[model samples]
Target: MSTAMAPEPVDNGGDARTRRSIARAVLANPTMVTFGALAVIILAFSALAPGLFTQGSNFVQLAQNVAILTVVSVGTTFVIITAGVDLSIPSGIVLGQVFAVQALKLLPLGEGTTAFDATANQTTALSVLVAVTAALLGGLIIGLINGVVVAYLRVPPLLATLGTLGAGLGVALILQDGVNSATYALDPVGNGALIAGIPNLIPIALVVVIAGFVLLHLSVFGRHTYAIGSNPEAARRVGINVERHLLKVYVLGGVASGLAGFLSLSYFSTTSIGGFSTANLQAITAVALGGTSLFGGVGSIIGTLIGVWIPAVLKNGFIITGVQPYWQDVAVGFVLIAAVWFDQLRRRSRDRG
Candidate 1:
């Protein structure tokens, strides 16, 4: 109205500065952004569903839902850090579960022959040892095969893991006659609570998180892992023994899957042979969404933990909010793709600068 034309439209470059600031902040601590997203989801879901999503019991349930996943993802986080994939994680987990159950049969548990007929009272220390050992060995074997094929035989990581995925599951099926077995040998570990009666799974997961954090973030082994993923040739020239280190990495991943299998059996009191078919994809998605580059050399235990929770919250929230179940997959897919794209973009920017 005053015909001043807003002083010819001031252009102070504040928008550019703000964007640059955000980019710098994100570049410095990418995990923070993912955590922020998780926080937002929690808040949004809590708001949308009110008391349902914010209940203490629901959170405990949420923790239980993700505990096994958190355990399994520890080694997976390392694998991705080395720029490798372990598609056989689910099979490895199932094998562990199967091994634990079969080992239980060798004990005097007196099962009544039903799929879930075993009781918690039948659990014994010897039975526990057998189950744990069997599960760990089963998972470790799968990991070893993957490591050998990928490291020495020059098979691509994807193909090697894919082969093991089917093979491991097949072995499990053969051992169990394609049926999930039951034993409460791990019931104490699975359902027992410590410190204020928290579910045992959460504490077990917390321990794994601590161990994984130490292994991946604070040790030379972790450094070697990042170096290998960042530049294998350079890592090799530096005497990193890329092949052996990779083998160890795959082994570690297998061990983690095996541990997850044991924990899963403990929690469910049965082998969930058909329950975790998509678990590998879920682990990959969590790792990717937590800012680990698919191309490798970037990730963290904390990030993976948060990544595990995002979808868990979404599914739980969606149910509470009456959203269609399929939308959860659609939402998670979009988030994962966006994360990977942003990761690629960040990588390009780093290379350029």
Candidate 2:
């Protein structure tokens, strides 16, 4: 019997065309469209409220106001990239503030008693630093629990974080009721300056945002996050330790949340039981608005920063333009819905193509 020669492999010319078509379709997605729309709105508002929105002092306030939100949103970006939702971040932040404040009062200081009279500038500075450290530690511990439950125990992300959310809120409430010193306020200050116009929180927030973006965008840890989020099985099969990477991701998130909490304290100066209830949601919304996929993988810290700023800018502008405070929240809700819708459109177009 004569063996027939093996047929030569056929090269299809359709693959490149299909890819280009898909690329064009994705570019038309709602997320990209809304980002452009939001930019227009910001510019329009800036133009209309030139006196109020474009002022130097208003810019400073904007920076300070959005700082905490930006920090928390960065953490959410990491969690979401892993196809996880961390509802516990707000509670963790609140407790961090509470513990940090408590630590300040209880910790020893130079020639000071357990009860500190924060009247002196030097003592005040030291206390604030101590408070920041305490908050950071609190976030780290909670993050560790979150990572352990999800990674080792194979618990669902929502349930794991939900448990921590309730637990953390309870802890904050306990701190408020037990410590009586929960209402202390921070005084804004300039360091013995003859002439100066700057809010200290603005610098801190800038630093946090830039540093977080760098770590998440430029580091190996960040690359691993994308790898796991995009394909857990493939990442593992390639020798990437998924469990360990997950733990580190959650830990970094916790640290970011802690820093956010400390910053919140600086802005509000008091830790209330009801505080930050909507913060986690807001952070998630910001992350989503910035084009981060809720289904895992794909995200941008720069986009998050812009997303955080837009809402804050709109809110501030609305207040200045005499709109009812309640209307501002309503407007933000509408914008968030539009953004999600856009993201959905993008995903569908990409999938279809």
Off by over 4 Å in 2: 1-35, 109-112, 124-126, 178-196
Q: How close is every model to the real structure, measured as TM-score?
A: 0.90, 0.84
| Ten residues in sequence with the least summed lDDT for candidate 2 | 186-195
Model 1 stretches with alpha carbons more than 4 Å out: 1-23, 109-118
- Listing every candidate in turn, what is its Cα RMSD in Å to the true structure after a full C-alpha superposition? 8.3, 7.3
Instruction: Kindly list the per-residue Cα lDDT of model 1 for residues 294-318, writing each as its tens digit.
Output: 7888988888999999999999999
| Candidate 1: residue 337 Cα off by (Å) | 0.7
TM-score of 2: 0.84
Cα lDDT of all candidates, in order?
A: 0.87, 0.76
lDDT of 2 by residue, 1-353 (tens): 23357655444658997788766665664445556756786688778887887788888778767878888888888989888888888777877777777787786654755423454343466666677789898888878889999888989889998898889888877867744243343444212222356666666667777887887789888888988988999999999999988888887778888887777765666665477888888888888878888888878787687778768877887888777767768887888887777777767767853
Q: Give the best candidate by TM-score.
A: 1
